[model samples]
Target: MKYLLVREDDEGEDELWGRCANVEGLFVDPVPPPREVLTFRGCTPAGPLREAVSRPGESTALLGNGYVEASDDTQVDWWELVDAVVLAHHPSRSDPSLVDVVVGAGVKGAGGGGFRRSGPSRFELFVGNNVSAGQSLRVDGLLAPRQDPAKIPMELIGCEPTGRLLSALRRPRKREGDWAELWALDRTGQVMAHPAVGLGIDGTRPSVLGGTLIDITLTDGGDDRPAPAARPVWEAWYQGVPTVPNQWAPYSSQGRSAWLRLALHARRPRRPDRSGGVHHLDGRFVTDVPGLHCAMSEALAGPGGYFGWGWDAFRDCLCGGFGLTPPFTLIWHDADIARQAPADAVSACEGLLSYAEEIVQVLEDVGVTVVLA
Candidate 1:
């Protein structure tokens, strides 16, 4: 309910659009960005397909879809499912293409099942090196990751009739390129998440509830609501804005994960790295993977600040602009908490290493001096 929509002024400062009294589609279910899913339907297996799938790291290269093969152009909409893992390949169902013949994971149903495509297509799956199978493939009409949302309906209350909102609606063509950040706040005036959105011409109407109703386009519509288990953490944050360290230590693992996610979502643009400072990290609460990330994020940036949620994002943060630059000393207080907490394995070239070791290795690799205090 506490939402603030703000766009940049000519002077490059965020100009608030007053308070948003009522908003729809702002706190809706979070739809993750769509990934490329290789869906093969109805096609029978060939050349020891089951045996090839049983083997580890069995990759399958889909040459081209029916859409590509029917066309005259040389460009094929090709996709390869690397380390391809078969989710379901049962040929015993009544309808051959009703709801079966799932393929690959991660991008499409990691645990439950693989992604399914609608319609029909003729494609060949080259599995391993010797085995090959014919597949009826079709790419679904799901929105791609880079595609913008069609619309995000919102209503602003207490806005001036001759204000920027009215002005933008009057001449949408001239201001069509404008974008704004919609910042949602908690009950205690703490920011929840700020998603960037663009203005639109259509569906801009005066609300019957004495406000302006506008349909904005989402640049990125991240999930606004916290998890049920993590609601207490948000409530705790509402009790007091996290200014010091260890504020996230008292929450459960699930709550901590949600907290880290919220921190990641609420990340603002960072100033240029001054490039020198000893970032002291309290490791007493590094009981889980999420806790480790939460501590690291809060340590590097501030309370509710984010460095990274995972190793890749961590490396990205170290590149610059995430609070402290590398080459500075990271005096990790109570480092043994992480080292002796648990044996979490991380993928490495030689073999698997504990997550703690991986963290230290990543830090050292990035030119940050790590001190185990």
Candidate 2:
């Protein structure tokens, strides 16, 4: 495999920065959530706080005092205002794990005590104890590194020192907003992964092969890549290898997801919707989420056409310009293959209903008459 470094110039054109004989630190883990400290005030305990204090290691949500003015929004869950889990409670010294600092205590019925703007609280929180949606997404992990928080570290081995790279190294220090993209390519020069990165130059030295070795750190801006195991699948696709139906069925859930992601990224631009006609989706191989996507893409726009990668993306496709507008008829031949098959792990976690069932409903909802045969 070879690596290429590229950058987008002011005109938004991709300029090749240089090519590397070898590159390291492309694969990475997702960035962890930022640590936060929250403090609550007052004194008293409606429910025994001992349960939380007893199990310091276990995570538990801290509830609101129920005294604040309720929001007019009907969707609000007032009962559980702070949804994050508590990592450590510091009031009691029973557990030695907690940091020695009492910020606030969970006071039970501090009569008429609304959300205080300022005052000494007896509780302090850290890390997982703050408001957050959830952990970093799995896709993020494949795009960047997990060092110094959310930065990617890379060492370019035997780099063909370009004027651009050499000039950057000669600078006294890196300027703000130094950025580039690292692309991985196969032996046949097919691009595999390309991720936008914020570059931090470490140093540069001469290589044994007369090339320069440059070490740098990178922060992921975003990327088009997949897990290592799934690269072969994409490579084959790039080589125009015939895809046997259900070819993706045997891959692991993560692999299937990677395959689908790469397919979505690699899909051809949406062609104008047909004026009028029926489209037939070959559903014989629709045994998994990725397969469903592959079959659907080919069905709508011919070979290698992309309709959507998932329900949301599919809905977007149905809105228009994806080779087929709404109100079209779709004959899903051998649809039972999808109906009877268990969903891949990626789809199963999305919802209880099978993805096939959801796909049909989405189509029908948008006026696409689905003939499940």
Candidate 3:
């Protein structure tokens, strides 16, 4: 089995220790030097140094093995020498031998250790067992190969209630470009419909809603640039009293006529007695201003009733002339003809729209509610 040799202190280098015969020392020196010594690393036996003591000839041979010293001066043992060599080769963190060293050194878990500021961008740790949440650990000297944050198996530690443990291990959220690329590849829009997207709306732009986030930067033309800020626009919708359907074809004469008929009836006042006295005019056949005038004059005509086609005349009639009373209704069908006037009458069409809006506003002011589709 492979072993990751780790250093006991920062004073020396780490190395890989294994059982092989080509190493410098392990067997006793012969009367005549052999071609090579049966050794592992700089020591002999090519195996766990502890096992050499149990074996008969191995113990005697290893005692004379130059790598191991029984003297108190060096304080070097066969096992310690093997550990140094194994760690020098940089074994994987998951190696059992490496794990033993780290755990034996008092590190509670894989990432649990105490940390201290070493520099502006770097920190040092005194890794040992019993590290608490929010505390950093140092495993630099214990593990064969140094572990990078990205490659570390952070899930080995259970999640803490305070979440600091996981936060310390987790990678930062992906940037806007990365998110957008992911979304584009999603094909299905389900990712856009996620609830998190809505929650993030407060921090996002309107253009990016239902899509991915975008990073935006603003400058104030200064050397000391400040962080960018954005103000969001909000919109609202109100459901007023229900009347006619809200669908209308503004480009078609017939559709406009239908709309006018519905609007007029929707705005008609209800009598206390609820009798059928409301005036309604079906002007679907009326194409131009003259035809419109003729139709209105005939429908509104009563005792001494006289209507006109001009804007001024129409306004006057609506104000109470033409023998029409308040609380009355005029269902003007096909009123859209004026709105869809010929190319030569574009100005007239615009004027018609303006007049209609004004007229609707005025009528609504007098308790009339027009439902224009």
In model 1, which runs have C-alpha deviations exceeding 4 angstroms? 8-18, 21-25, 32-102, 106-162, 167-179, 185-193, 198-241, 250-280, 319-323, 326-351, 369-373
Candidate 3 Cα misplacement greater than 4 A, ranges:
1-276, 302-305, 343-373
Q: Write the per-residue lDDT of candidate 3 for residues 107-205, one digit (tens) a residue.
A: 111332222224322112210111111111222332233222211000101111123212322434422221101110012211111000110111212
Worst 10 residues of 3 by lDDT: 229-238
| lDDT of candidates 1 onward, in order | 0.57, 0.53, 0.27
TM-score versus the correct structure, for each prediction = 0.51, 0.59, 0.22
Candidate order by TM-score, highest to lowest?
2, 1, 3
Candidate 3 lDDT score at position 116: 29
Tens digits of per-residue lDDT for model 1 on 219-303? 3333344445776775666554567787788887778877777777667676777576788888888877678888988878889
Residues 1-373 of candidate 2 have per-residue lDDT tens digits of: 2778898889999877777777555444444334333333222222223334456565454432222111222221111222233344454243343322212222221223233323222221212112122111011111122123344455676676567766776787764477787776655676655766655676566764563364444334333334566655655555642345445556665566665665555555555666457888888777777678878877776654567776568788888866678778889999888878863222331224466777788788877888888
Report the backbone clash tally of model 3.
Answer: 27
The 10 consecutive residues of candidate 1 with the worst lDDT sum are: 63-72
Cα lDDT of candidate 2 equals 0.53
The per-candidate count of clashes, in order, stands at 0, 10, 27
